[model samples]
Target: MKKTMKDQKMVLIILLSNIFIAFLGIGLVIPVMPSFMNLMHLTGQTMGYLVAVFAMAQLIMSPFTGRWVDRYGRKKMIIIGLFLFAVSELIFGLGTNVSVLYIARVLGGISAAFIMPGVTAYIADVTSDEERPQAMGYMSAAISTGFIIGPGIGGFLAEYGIRMPFLFAAAIAFVACVSSIFVLKEPLTKTQLAEIAANAKQANFISDFKRSLQPLYFIAFIIVFVLAFGLSAYETVFSLFSDHKFGFTPKDIAVIITISSIFGVIVQIFLFGKMVDRLGEKKLIQICLIAGAILAAVSTMISGFWTVLTVTCFIFLAFDLLRPALTTFLSRAAGIEQGFVAGMNSTYTSLGNIVGPALGGILFDVNINFPYLFSAVIIVIGLGITIFWKEKQLG
Candidate 1:
């Protein structure tokens, strides 16, 4: 059958569903992490390592996964990725030991490595350049929406059992997996296929990584890494920070996260595309980096409930805007190498995530406010790097 524009829209929705469902598992875990720390007798450092392990796995797999999506087809990778996502969530739901949780985290990271780049490349295949920013905005909204709902539901689910939300996440991922098998189609066109085939001989991760290191691409990857690192300083340590310093309950964490994420989703859906067009990626990135740095520092000083909530909302909003703007920038710059660039983006992000939380965890042990304060410093460094980035290079 000849695909209609409506059919293309349906495929995009399905692709976004894969992203939403995968991140939903991550969101579900955030609210219940303090309980997890208690259950497993974990330290701030160990918890930090736990988050890092996932990113480590992603970092290890992303270069390979990037090539796979281009070589094997986006549809195949999406199905396999979702299947792994289900299994990872299932393990997390059932495991009692930290070892088991680590294994699950590894599989979850691998699944993300497969899914994110595959979905991103698929969307790039189907959309025109003019349409991509809005399409990517909706994709970002799906991820934020997952975060919006998951923590709130996770807070309630934890009341029944700390493991309940993971099981629910597993079930939902499986459903998405099954639906993708039946419903999702490969959107790659003849031109993209030819480009993939041309890059086929040089398929090694080393070569791919080297290819991605061109002047135009290298700085973007650095920004992605720095962004993840800075965000992790706030995120991976957030629950522990709040519970220890402020005596917040799971529900309080849930309320703050869900509310903040809702605001992120609103701007992503309604404003992001317009903002990208008017401001351009470079300006949006610079603005958000400044916002993130200032807010991270500000977050360290605030302790009152309402004040913390306000700062956190801005933090989340800046990050939400920054991520898509970066992704849109890379996608526009990549030309025929969408999957390759997406994979590299994930790789750098994983590298940042690996380092950020692990360091933040150690710093958290020394001082409760240290992690976010450090994040402010990291984001300023990223902003400094961005000063070298010129808008004309993308064309």
Candidate 2:
């Protein structure tokens, strides 16, 4: 069935809105998390472990959530995920203990595992190959916009109290949740539904997972892992680096994140998908990875607020473009099992999250700039993987 323009527009709005709210909650916490932990009297490895815990939870649950979306429906998974996110946010408000906060993050991670893959699969279901890259870009831009707003708002509110940000984040999520329930529609076609039904009944999780490890998928996985890893590492160390190098306050760093987020939105919304459609995601991925790596390496050479901020904005643009194209390519590659396939993509990302922040934290204790340099090395390796990886004829 040919989709109407209205259907496409509605789905686009719904998907973008969902992503916007989710990231709003996340970005709000990013600037304040280390300080929040300090309030609980935690530091060092404990904080690193907390970061790992969030990623680890997502890694553990993503595959199951993906499969569940395949068997059930994307809409169902989305609503459930958002509901869980609401609960997680409430948990944050209910406690001041580090242990309780850790549990909230774990819950948040699980919610994320479900929400992200489900939304990707839903967009895949609605959009044609020709339209998909652009749609993905728009969704990514919505996320970047949230990143821009959330940090600034969170930082401002944090002066009153950290818990206030949590309350505000949750309130925003609740509003989005209500909008999702009424506004989002399931867009899967009959053939797509049948395809999922057939695959869902007989596919062995372990066997199918092993078989899904084609060179293209493997390359895509590596690309996503490196991208996520590098970004997470940067985020984990940003506050620390800003403080040490430029004596930046939390509010100042929040402003940096907000500005970088604006660059990220421009790149994702205006540049990325169209660039990929014109140049191909494969070439764009290669270019962005190389450029990002170079920029990251250069970031280590800079000191003080202005230089760091300049490089950070460039890095954000590089990152914003790379991720959407990577995800769009991976979703297209999944063929009939889009949810499960997309889930694996999320799993690899979570794996990167688990590794990047932990390693960055450990390296930070050793030297402040090592993490950035290390991220450059990882990106180069991913670019090399993309070179030899064969492209599969998806769909």
Candidate 3:
């Protein structure tokens, strides 16, 4: 029994590491995005579309990706996903043109679509219902920790060359992929796959677009879309906004994001599961939305380094907490359909992501602060939607 438990813990570690690498890859490019733009002489609008393109690919591929995981097996999809991640990063690092960059982002998105659901479903298969939330918290912590480290490293690496960070990300991801091939084992048995296959015919992501909606999930999915939209709007152009507005260098941008994310990482590591147990997902979601909206507005008004850092810290805290809260709520309501819910979450998030960057990019071109202001408005609207939502409906 003890040996079994030890092995399970190791497997969880391996799975969570994939999330860390993916987010780290994401954070790696953020600080250098402005430099990349300048190198290509790309406008804010073009850059926004650049960011949006990733989501567009993810959105397009996500519905099918989920099915592929269930059909092909989690470990198989994860291996493929990681390899794709490595390819995307390397391509982005080597590319000299905008079209090439778009191709890289598309591959990155598809990798994300594969890895997230694949790893998540793999974990769900191995863990009990009671152990699932804590495991999920660990997953979120991995992402937060990535945010803490990736930008800081990427910023300093920019000193060497703007493309250096992408190359570094690619190298590490390839290593992880090769390691996973040898170290990871498929956890699902024949019976488990058969059980999941039984529910495989439920409404997929794209099917919902034409239908009215499932009232049980309608409000929750709406909030998901708004949350992703609002976050992506400001986030897509954050580096450029900083560069143009305050003349902050890549290192300065990295310092701020890294520092701001540190506190959130700590909270996720220690307090996240308990906070969810105490506050319930609905209340926590509401709190985060309001706090985030206020912080988004405040971030734009602040000029000093310390003040901006402080506001940004709170902003990251709200987002870090909000994501898990929403995800936990969805998972709880999902019952045996964890993979399906995870896929839906990715789909709605992609929808928000697709729209947010495009609009935010245009707005940023007009005024650097417009993206944040626009995000605040969107978040406030999300809060309003949640006001009437009762927690019991999740059942």
Candidate 4:
């Protein structure tokens, strides 16, 4: 029993590490966006397109990847995803034109489609129902940790060159890919694999997706979408906003994001599970949405580095808590459809990512404060949905 428990812990660690590497690759580019814009001679709208393109590709691929993870097994897909991530980062690092950048973003999106659902389903496979929330919280923390570390490292590296960070991200992803190839084990047993194979043969994609999209799941999807949209809006324009408002350089923006993500990691690791246990997913979701809305509104009015940092920390903390809570809620509601539901969740999030940045970029071009105000309104709509949503509908 102790040996089995030890194995589980080891597997969880590897999974968490893999997720951390993937997110680190994504976040490493954030602090360098201003540099990219300058080099590419791009405007806010074009920059938005660059961000949205990645999510659009991910949105297109997520459902298919979810099914593929079940069919091909999680370990295989994860390694492939990591390899693709490395390729994408390398392409972006070496590219000289917008077309190449777009291609790289598309590759990144494809990688995420495979990685997100694969990692999520792998976690679900290894954890018992009771342990799932905490496990998901840990996963969220891993992601937040990547966000915390990536920007700081990228900022420091950007002194060398803007493109240097992308190269570093590629190197990190390549190492992760190699590690996954040798060290990661499939979580599913032979019997479970056979069962999943049988179910895959029996289930059509459309039917399975429809089944997963029942009213409760739909509400969960909306929450996921709203969270993604609001956060993306804040993030997409943040570098531009800070640069315009406070004359923040890439390093300054990186510091703010890194500090905000640090508090987020702490909240996810230490407070998220406890809050979920006490408040329940529904109530917690509501609370986070309300807090996020208020924060978004207040953010537009704030100035100075310290004040911005203080508000952003709370905003990120709320988002961190909201994510795990929503994941737990959806997972519990999913029961036998873990992979499908996880894929759908990613799809919803990708959809929001597609819309949010596009809108945010246009809004940022209009006025710096518009994006934040827009995000607040979106959060309020999500809150309204949550209020009217009946918990009993889940059954």
Q: Which candidate gets the maximum lDDT versus the true structure?
A: 1
Q: Which stretches of candidate 3 lie over 4 Å from their true place?
A: 1-7, 31-48, 96-99, 155-163, 202-205, 208-212, 237-252, 300-303, 364-370, 393-395
Q: Show the colliding residue pairs in model 3.
A: none
**Candidate 2 stretches greater than 4 Å from native:** 4-7, 31-46, 96-99, 159-161, 189-194, 201-209, 249-252, 391-395
For all candidates, what are the clash counts?
A: 0, 0, 0, 0
TM-score of each: 0.90, 0.90, 0.86, 0.88
For model 1, the stretches where C-alpha displacement exceeds 4 angstroms are 1-7, 31-49, 96-100, 158-162, 189-194, 243-250
Tens digits of per-residue lDDT, candidate 3, 243-326, equal 877888878887888787778878877887787777777888899999999999887887867877888888888988887777
Which regions of candidate 4 are displaced past 4 Å? 1-7, 33-47, 96-98, 158-163, 200-212, 242-252, 303-305, 365-368, 392-395
- Checking candidate 1 for backbone clashes, the offending pairs are none
| Model 2: worst 10 consecutive residues (lDDT sum) | 201-210
TM-score for model 1? 0.90
Instruction: At residue 281, give the lDDT of candidate 4.
Output: 82
* Ten contiguous residues minimizing lDDT sum, candidate 4: 1-10
Determine the backbone clash count of candidate 4: 0
* TM-score sort, best first: 2, 1, 4, 3
lDDT of 4 by residue, 1-395 (tens): 11332458877887898899999888788778888899889897778678778888888788788777776788988999999999999999999898998999999999998888888888877776657778899999998888777776887889999899999988988898888888878766667766776776443546656765678788789889999999988987888888998888878887788788888887788777788777888889999999999999998888998998899889988888888888888877766556777788898898888788879988988888999999999999999988777877533
Measured over all alpha carbons after superposition, the RMSD of each candidate to the real structure, in angstroms, is: 2.8, 2.6, 3.3, 3.0
**What's the lDDT for all of these models?**
0.85, 0.81, 0.80, 0.84
